[model samples]
Target: MSATDLTSAAEGHGTGSSVGTTDLIDVEATDFMPDDSVAGAAADLPAADVAVRAQQLTKRYGNLLAVNQLDLVVPRGSVFGLIGPNGAGKSTTFAMMASLLRPTSGRIIVMGADPSKKPRTVRRRMGYMPDNLGVYDNLRVDEYIEFFAASYGIHRSEWTALVDGLLELVDLSVKRSAMVNSLSRGMKQRLSLARALVHDPELLILDEPASGLDPRARVELRELLKTLNGMGKTIVISSHILAELEEMCTDIAIMEAGKLLAAGPPREILERLGGARTVKVRFATGISETFTVADDAEQAALLRRLLVDEGRDVVEFVEHSGGLEQLFMTITEGVVQ
Candidate 1:
């Protein structure tokens, strides 16, 4: 039940196999034809400025409105993180952008193509790694990567080198011959990432990628993602790990109850949302004071008044900006839908 099964079935590589509901929910199936109308409209956008744009996107499951009029834009070549609590519809939003699910209302443009109308075009340019690894059973690590490579229509001769490069990229070259089921959770997560990159996509959509990794594995994943972003790939990631996201993401969107609470560069959002910066000052006279400022200008004015105007013997001055965890706690009311 690997993600390759969904790719193979969707891309016409499999015969008439049936995919389970759980598999369908977690994996991306991309084999639909393109629509010229949607393609032409998407082409009107400035491709360099945006990678993914959603205009009032909505999704409903019968009586449940999973995603509600969520509007978002991910700039190209940026690491965008989606933050939300459980039942926040982040996964639903990702599924729509990946072309695995159609929106109940509104429009979504991914890589300048409408995923609902031009799924093939969108899917070919994007790679998706879900939270669950699915079932790998007896497949070897190399075999698993090769399976996805073939599913993406890569030549059989090129698979050896491709698999080698991907395994090395995920630091799993030594486990190339080991059974996928025998690997630990972290190793399987890395393997799944390799599977997603088999086609060398321009965009990567990762959901809870660091869900079960150890601290070392999480650090490795963060560095690897930064490397990929440096290589000009736009990454959209969703995680409850706010600290990691704060360190790695260039832009972030916070969602709650299927609604966007904030979206932009972290600093800009912090400034706009009235996030305060704490300044600590120590004097040579064994006296210390702490002040909270709203922005850099205020922080600078305070420093100037103390050192120049007051003529005080300031020994140390340090400023601390609020972190993403604080922002999340401040903005979200713990509401789950």
Candidate 2:
């Protein structure tokens, strides 16, 4: 049960660079422009580290409540996961945060500006990739990216260099001249992501980004997101696939039937929901022991006592953990309103 042995034993774990703008890019501050609306609202951001906050956020459709009295806060420079079963109001909440839908009652503050009040400011600061992304089949990859960069009001002088850099970031540089329709599902998904980043927004609201991707594609997407996060972008992602989120997210929020069931780091939510995790200890003699613990500290302390106090020859000490899936099930009733 030595530290090195424990490190080798606990192997049940699951899963950064900057690009400089070259002189060939040759862009002044004015060369890289945002929309007029964005420019006007950019100066009005309140000084705050809270990237997004929802106060009693609710949305109703006639007699049906899509989201009910939900409160959420997302900090800057974090990869956040928003998860729920079908009809759990995740999409509704995302819509409100993205300024695509108005709330029935409540407020959404994104990047220190209320999206409803100053949507322009939020738009300039946030990049949203919906679950169902549309692609212009006729447009080439570079053309598609250029279209969005221009829509964000990037000046003509910077479009070529900007689009090129974004394509490289998404691993689509070689496909730049390829037609959008000619690409596979995975390639198209990556292209959509490149489109989202064209604006150089600080926050990315991504819905089901890995929906139909193959295993390799999903891994690639996850790595790309991590790179973006390393470069200081706060990303809010939603997906039905719990395991994927469990691996990539820094924090998560769960919802059921339009109500937030839990929100926080995965471990905190798991503990709050009374989720129990087990520790598996194997001795050199082929004997094993299992102990259930409420938290990591407890598990660590137990291991120490077993090794030091009892002088046990521990060969393996694996944390048979309860992850995000366990916490999601523990907190949600699976009822769809």
Candidate 3:
């Protein structure tokens, strides 16, 4: 459970639902396309049922370009992950998407409302949790969520059940009366998550929501998010923990030095980046064989023939696909903007 051992963490934690790699790339390329046309390199991709679309989205701080004409589209009802190295414009992108920071140039369509033109409209439909979330030390967990809910303009009549349900959803129901500062880091992280869900927004923009949590806490967080997604909430999350995102995210966008390296489902990105799948054949004679194949169908066909026609004593046949971290390394050169 070492905080730095994210590789092992990714392997240990599993999503509640099974995510198949087959046709994932094509699905992302087609279904997750932007709703409107984008300028620059992203102009060619088609549009679909997008929850958020950024067309030539850019942000510049003086001379530094924090986000460079980034074209991104998150499909509705998806758990989308935004991944990158340090200073990879992830935070900046989140800010613009949440309508917190003004983009120097470009358009951001959040749930069909332009954040720049209709900030209030977009704000009502989205809930944002920054990486450095601050808590009121004196306020109790229930009070904290209540404060935000009120601020979001929720009716007082619905407060009781709304707060209770959100607390239970994040596994903080027992800590409702506890002071925010008295809670552990994991509890506080969950509390922040509850705070974001207070308004019942259509989209949740989370910046490193699991940043300070331990391994076990991270698993709990993942399960909670899966439940939320199953309830029809669209989530856009950014984290250094690639493995967790690899399992939880339906699709991903990889950025480096304020530039996009790739965007799509992990399997699609891996396939396009020349990532090969591994086939392991274990024989009954205590011997095993492994093959790296480009085409899984062809490999499976050959393996079946050897097992059935040639009468090979095969006990187990397993295929290992490349991981998200591997795909990230291959796509980006780790360059800084």
Estimate every model's Cα lDDT from 0 to 1. 0.79, 0.75, 0.77
Query: Cα miss at 202, model 3 (Å)?
Result: 0.7
| Residue lDDT tens for model 2, 1-337 | 1222212212312121222212212112112222212112222222354566776789999999999987776756778899999999988998898989999987777776677877887898789998896899999998998888889898777777776677767787789899999998999998998888877777899989999999999998998888777766789999988888888887788888887767766656666664678989999999998988878789889999999999999999998766777777777788988
Q: Which ten residues in a row have the lowest lDDT in candidate 2?
A: 24-33
Q: By TM-score, how accurate is candidate 3?
A: 0.84
The full ranking of all candidates by lDDT, starting with the best, is 1, 3, 2
lDDT by residue for model 3 over 1-337, one digit each (tens)? 1111212222334223222223312232343334222122233333334567776789999999999988887777779999999999999999999999999987777776678777887788788999996899999888898899899888777677777777766777789899999999889988898888777676899999999899999999998788767656789999999999999998788999887777777666767664677888898998998887877676778697878888999888888776888888877787887
- Overlapping backbone residue pairs in candidate 2 total 0
lDDT, model 2, position 180: 98
Q: Model 1: how far is 263 from its true place, Å?
A: 0.5
Clashing pairs in 2: none
State the lDDT at 293 in candidate 2.
85
Name model 2 segments beyond 4 Å from true. 1-47
Q: RMSD for each model, in Å, please?
A: 9.8, 11.0, 8.4
TM-score of each model, paired residue for residue: 0.85, 0.84, 0.84
RMSD of 1: 9.8
